[model samples]
Target: MGERISNSRVVISGMGVVAPNGIGLSDFEKALRNGISGIEFIPRLAALNFGCQVGGIPPITQEHIDACFSPLQLRNFNSDGIIYGMIAAHEAWRNAGLEPEAESLDPDTGVIFGTGTSGIEKLNESIKLVDAQKVRRLGSNVVIQTMASGVSAFIAGHIAAGNQVSTNSSACTTGTEALLMGYRHIKAGYAKRMLVGATCEHGPYLWGGFDAMRVTNYRHNDKPEQASRPLSETAGGLVPGAGAGAFVLESLEAALERGAPIIAEVLGGQINSGGQRGGGTLTAPNPEAVKSCIKDSLVMSGIEGAQIDLINGHLTATVKDPDEVAAWAAALGRDKSNFPYLQATKSLVGHCLSGSGAVELVATTLQLQRGFVHPSINSEDLHPQIAKWVPREKIPQQAIDVQLDRAIKASFGFGDVNACVVLRRYNS
Candidate 1:
């Protein structure tokens, strides 16, 4: 880690997001500012007799699909995660002023896009064909579509990435972990620029396991918009969602030389796990580990916890919301009276699972760039335990204007894994 201090500084040059609340950066920012809810009822889930019939699926139309994929490339393309990841990656590449159709491979640019369970829908289709003795009908695209690295592989080809192109999976921590991985790659001089993000597919096939675990909200089937209630007293289980968020990370020197639009500076980050010990389980995070991860992130960033203007927390509208708040407060050594402003993107977009961390990071970057804190909608009634650690004003219910200099984003996932990143508004 000490070597990173002397290496090149990493900064975000461009960003693209396909969140349930919004598709592109402009619409995402608008949706966040306006506190629009993207969770809605799905007829397919209802027809499937799912306990939770509503979800946060991005409203991707045929036009959106056509813009990113050619007719030939779209053949037998059933992986929603790959489509979302490619769309976001292409947008990020173009946003950074790079041509995706470049004939030559970019040795200096790579990809670290990730997904939790890629192409579950495609896998299901292939299974049915194989069971029915129609193996030949599975087609040549099945392997690419159903592979866990499909998202990264597709984007790497689209951009002609000749560097380290790979995918990582750590349950819900996948996105934030991918961002940190890219940051380290540039800091270590492994690549000059890297496209980093995560994507996840939605629908019963992928979400059924969570529903069976009884971790998904089943009470809000009638009122979809109010389903995800992070930090609220009436909060239920999480509402499953899917989407992708991507960013182009390059060295500060490279970005300046190329005249790229610097979105935010990646100060530093930390990734660790609780080892499922000391009260941590496969499904729950250890409080002490979460606090240590946050504290270490600030140390790596060379900033005190007091410098954090806001905390984009991984509050997934479950019993863990209060615990997460307590962890943040403890890590920063701040009380409710002086705690930094906290925002929960999941309140509006639900839990995007593997894609949640990256999508939330995009929202964090937009707030830092545009000077505002989007409201944590559906949290009008703060959780009692959380209210004891965070003041009501610290959790704004509506958008507020503020010149944010720095922010910290943290994601906690299953398997007791955690990832935290410190970001600053680009100064130069």
Candidate 2:
């Protein structure tokens, strides 16, 4: 069992994001504060057979399209994954200040990224072409392009990282799943460094599928930004958006030796599945599973709930999700008044699915770096029932006043795959 892989420290040395808020850490933060929703009005896709006129990453302009990727490169690749992975991974490597040609790191550096709803968009496009009698027009690259792991492979090539690379497709929990795997690799000494996170690209096919589930917002199509109201009374459902977030993980020792700027220490991460899989609604979460994961994660970190200063919740704009999660917190005997502060990043960036945890992870790191907490913009009135369980009124917006040092980010995937990660402020 390779010595059971025990007792090692992991740290988050760097991170990068490609959100609807656009690229660059500074610009992204501005959007977060100003509450600028990236969802826009696209005239072309608007006329398509769809129910909602909504927001999403706008169409790629010709100059940007041509400058970033070529027809040959994307010939067999999913355009959504290709665009997101390239931008996110590139920014992550640059942010780490790891010279592309650095010789200090080992060749065994690993990569494990989470991708939710991969290639569905491209698959839909190809199927449409077939229906239109454009048989010969179909490109030969369809098979490779639609592969879920295609983005991971493309990203590995860019870094010239000839090492172990893997991909996770665990719906919403995928990003945190990838990070957990990387943490294990470093702790087990299998790899000294790794790049992990998640990404998503919005497309008509994805939206249509969600619509079929009758879980998406149809009433607020005209007001795209208002479509997602996590803890609000009029909340209907999640407004699917697209973006990518990546993190560079390195052993604490390795990072200090290189003198790189460390963002936060990833103390421990744990995952748990719900009991009697079929008992819970396939698309929903379970309180037992949430409580189990939280308890187990704290045990792994060897910290009490009282030690954590913040709780970054997976508060997707839904009627039941917030209640389910708050119930779990209450079940653990966590006094709503004193346990930990709570904030939901989905309230800011919208839900990025695979990239949600990754983006929140970065957001938490920024909180630790700047000593400020981000508020769930526009959530003035939290649900009354949930307020009893979630003590904090709303995610704080002003500069952080307290000496907050540690936080937890929790994510729940579609199949009740609950993942919780703990982070500590870097004291250096």
Candidate 3:
């Protein structure tokens, strides 16, 4: 992992997003550029007496569902994560111009989809049914639907993948880690293309714990759009979100051979956990681990930190936002003036838990390809600690045109785990 493999550059050939802000690359890009707010008040949360009554959920319609699934596949499908993952995976496959229903399994292709808590809603329902002595009513697909590998399994079956289809869960770091793992497979010459992404099940069963833990914003229940204020001095807490993001990644050689549109090159990345040491816990990140993750990511990517044109932070609009900024400042060895443009995509889309990294990765790739930085909405008032570490002007509140030659996306999860990825524009 120290040296880059010759001719092993991984590039993003296609992307699909089922996010709170939008679905599909085109719509998601539009939402990002326009600074759209996807967080909304959920009456159910309010009715349930939740501390935070607002959240970000993708607005998937019946038509959208019909477009993604067949009549047979739709039957007995109780997993929201699976539904989201399928739509996103299919979108990425089609966007990459690859036919989903191949004649046979492409032995050199596979999937590495991830999820945080798989099908908790379905499991919750099943538990109640069994408690009521109605276990026989549970469908045959319940096991598959509620399993941790369900999303990846479904994607693999639908795409006819043959090489190493697997699911990975690392709290919130699942998505970025999955992408990097898929890239490693392609880089190692074990695969030609890897479908990589993550999804989180939508609903109270999945979100109630965070709400009970008082980690979500309750003040903005009356104003959902402004509730998730990442990097802002007035930021309260994270606004829980659910969705999926997918990408088709292949080696530059393979993408070129297939005449695929190169979106962004995956330079390299790092994945590690804090072991719950040095102020780290199940609920907070260790500053040292966060810093090391970034430093080693740069080393693996073979790029200087100064070369980072943009960063989509893991800032989740909580008290920890300042600590994240501080870690970034320390990791890059860049003071205020020399720092790169930093913004919180969570400011607009909220935190998608396990799906955040992949969704934000798609946004990061879009910025690289489109040569623009999406606005960091609801961060007009930067936290004093962050402003001390970064220049105010470096944070863009409106879409700005810039050559994003190199960018880094990082996700720090609940278990004090961290993952980072470096991406660069496809020059060739």
Best by TM-score: 1
Give the better candidate number (2 or 3) by lDDT.
3
lDDT of 1 by residue, 1-428 (tens): 11222389999998999989899999999999999999999999999888888999998888878877789878998999999998889889999988886798778889999999888888999999999999999888899998899899989988999889999999999999999999999998888899999998898988989888998899999999999999999998999898999999999888998899998999998999999998899999988999999999999999998889999999999998999999999998888778999989998898999999999999999999999999998888899999998889988898999999999999999999999999999997
- Per-residue lDDT over 1-428 for candidate 2, one digit per residue giving the tens place of the 0 to 100 score: 12232455788887877777666567676666566666554454467845555645723444534434557875555567557766777778778877444445346567888787567867877899999999787688776567778778766766656557878888788888788889988888877788888888777766667766766666676776666667765667776667787888988777887887788888887987774364445677777778778878888888887788888888887877666656556534576666566776766566777777777777777777667776665466667666666665435544344556888888888887889888898876
Rank candidates by TM-score, best first: 1, 3, 2
Clashing pairs in 3: none
Q: What is the lDDT of residue 136 in candidate 3?
A: 99
- Our tally of clashes for model 3 stands at 0
The per-candidate count of clashes, in order, stands at 0, 2, 0
Q: Please list the C-alpha lDDT of all candidates, in the order they appear.
A: 0.92, 0.72, 0.90
lDDT of 3 by residue, 78-131 (tens): 788988988999999988888876778777788999998777878988999999
- What TM-score would candidate 1 get against the native? 0.98
Model 2 misplaced stretches (Cα beyond 4 Å): 1-6, 41-46, 58-78, 101-106, 128-140, 275-279, 391-394, 397-403
In model 1, residue pairs whose N, Cα or C atoms come closer than 3 Å (at least 3 residues apart or on different chains), thus clashing, are none
Which of candidates 1 and 2 is the stronger one according to lDDT? 1
Worst 10 residues of 2 by lDDT: 58-67
